[model samples]
Target: GQQVMQIPQYQHVQEGEDFTTYCNSSTTLSNIQWYKQRPGGHPVFLIQLVKSGEVKKQKRLTFQFGEAKKNSSLHITATQTTDVGTYFCMFSGGYNKLIFGAGTRLAVHP
Candidate 1:
């Protein structure tokens, strides 16, 4: 079994501040998926990182995958109220199994 560990179990940031969450795994991962779950809402897929040393950005959100493919990070620049949610990093295992990290809950204050 594989496990993903995420740091900063909780984060509180001002509306214009930056926030980041780290995800690490002891084993190499084929791909990593990021999801955002808003309060009282289902999880929505954000993006997936597959290549080593890959970096992707969507608006103010930045995603990076480590060169070793054993780590990943999600950073939000200039946090907004809409960014308040639990961000999860997950990897798919064989047989339709998905392994998820503990997740980082973000709270934004306007």
Candidate 2:
């Protein structure tokens, strides 16, 4: 199926919680893009890094570009229920058809 599924498909946390998800790809990817999908909102591009050994952070989130570029990672600190949504990572290929990783769902409590 060429899909990567993360463990604990679902996660629930209190107002201040710690959450994490892992993604592994079948093949090497050129570029990795991360998107956040709100309950009723569309996928919005958060950030994109093309260079190897690249790292970027926004507020409470951290992103890393693997040295091999075949994999990547994202981490969040002090998660809030407001962070509820599915996060997807898209891999680029020859046909331009993006291969998306099974989304990681995060639910926070208040």
Highest-TM-score candidate? 1
Report the lDDT of model 2 for residue 82: 71
What tens digits encode model 2's per-residue C-alpha lDDT throughout 1-110? 45554445677877666776656666666778888899999988988868877889999988887787767777778898778998877777657677777778788888
**What tens-digit string does per-residue lDDT give for candidate 1 at 1-110?**
78889999999998999999999999888999999999999899999999999999999999999999999999999999999999999997666889999999999999
Candidate 1 regions exceeding 4 Å error are none
Clashing pairs in 1: none
Cα distance off (Å), candidate 2, residue 57:
0.3
- Model 2 lDDT, full chain set: 0.76
For all predicted structures, in order, the TM-scores are: 0.97, 0.85
Model-by-model lDDT, in order? 0.95, 0.76
Candidate 2 total steric clashes: 1
* Sliding window of 10 residues with minimal summed lDDT for model 2: 1-10
Give candidate 1's error at residue 81 in angstroms: 0.5
